[model samples]
Target: MNNTVVVAIPATTANMGPGFDCLGMSLSLYNEIHMSLTPGFINIEIEGEGAEDIARDERNIVFCAAKRVFTEIGESCVGLSIKLINQIPASRGLGSSASAIVGGLVAANKLTGSRLSQERLLDLATEMEGHPDNVAPALLGGIIVSVFQEGKVHYLRVSPPEGLNAVVAIPEFHLSTHSAREVLPKQVSMKDAVFNLSRSALLVAALCQNRLEMLRVAGTDALHQPYRTKLIPGMNEVIEGALQAGALNVTLSGAGPTVIALTDGEKPAVNDAMKGAFQRAGVSCQVKNLKPTVEGARII
Candidate 1:
């Protein structure tokens, strides 16, 4: 087995409206990690995204994930060297942490003869990430509907429709996932629960059946988006503007300061509308049109 490996993990968007902690889709954007085993030393080099904020030593999430692989497989690595080229923005709901965790696990597994199976890797990733929503797609790619059940992650991957694309309006500020979760109430009303359940199920069906027009209904949420809107200035305007500009659906991307719109039409118009709405609401943001990618993490 090779002692070094390069893994490219795609950025993922979770929730996709009403699926809350269950649905996610991988985007074309990626973060690449070049990892190698070294004796008696650990080093990490980060370029792009959270270069200044991300830890560079053993405490780094990449290193911690790689170490988990070695521990799980009963192998020993004296040290590790990790180089990250981050294309996905950090803490803006783009699955940056999931990419790092998946990249580290994949790269280290390769370096150590790949003792762990993909299922095992998924389980490990879920353990680290606290949920399978983002990590499932980051590891397996495409659209993933996952749940943590009976101490394991059960997931199904749905192939994105031929023309489906995402327009993401990313705010300049960061919103931590912790902060977002804190805003959520401990127990939602049964009416809201049923509301999300129907929409989440509809989202899954729409993706599976290639029913693009149904996405607008599927993207409506009654769970987290309503409460978290205060955390993201102009969230409602961004969603409304994107939809008005012909996007099929729009929602907060993961625990977002980023809003993503799914569109098979007028992507540029949707992009401009999302940006303009944020600007009108006194928020500065950047927009990117990213395609859905079926490919996940892999050695390169």
Candidate 2:
């Protein structure tokens, strides 16, 4: 048996449109973790993304998540050495932390004899992340529709349709999830609730049926984005720009400083439009044309 395990975890975009706290899709970007057992010490190496900000000590999220796995199985792993090669941007609504948590869990599971089922690992990952939106896709891949109830995650994965892609415009500044959530209200009107519910259902159905045109209406939101626009300068303008450039739909990617557009045609134009909107707002941004991935975290 191999003593060392390397796991690759994909980045994810959560809360696609009106499906707040439930919908997400895995992207082509990935973070890889290389782990090996040690005698009695924990060693961690971080590269790329938020390397300077990520902790090297046991306080690190990856180490904490991995430790949780060891404790969960009642197995004593003396120590571990983990190297993270990260490509996902942290605090950009791109599921960077989710990738880290899932990476650590999957790598440690493999190192410890692969005792846990995917469902069990997902429950653990959701417990750590406080929600299943991001972690679900990072762990299971493709597009995930998830719900967390009674301390467990219930989810289903949707395979993306061919020829569809995402044009993501990621701004330079970091927007912490905590800060983003703090800006939202505790209660909303019934009319707003119904609005979001209808759209969320439509979004899921449209994705499933490969009816791309329906996304224009399905991606409209009344729950989070309306309030979140204040936190993200020029967000509405960015959405309009993408729409004008032939995007099927546009929405905030998680609790974003990033904006994403869904398109089956003119991807480059949509990318440019999003970037230009951000620039006009005096916000520096980078754009990436990424495809949805069907594969999730796995030992490689």
In model 2, which regions exceed 4 Å deviation? none
**Backbone clash tally (model 1):** 0
The collision pairs in model 1 are none
Compared with the true structure, what per-residue lDDT tens digits does model 2 show for residues 1-300? Answer: 357999999889999989999999999888999989887998999999999999998898898888988998997768889899999999999999999899889988888888889899999999999999999999998999999999899898999988889888999999999999998999999999999999999999999999999999999998888888998888999999999999999999999989999999547889889999999999999999889999999778
- Candidate 1 per-residue lDDT, tens place, 117-143, comes to 999999999999999999999999999
Best by lDDT: 1
**lDDT score, candidate 2:** 0.91
Measured against the true structure, the TM-scores of the candidates, in listed sequence, are 0.98, 0.98
* Runs of candidate 1 exceeding 4 Å displacement: none
Model 1 TM-score is 0.98
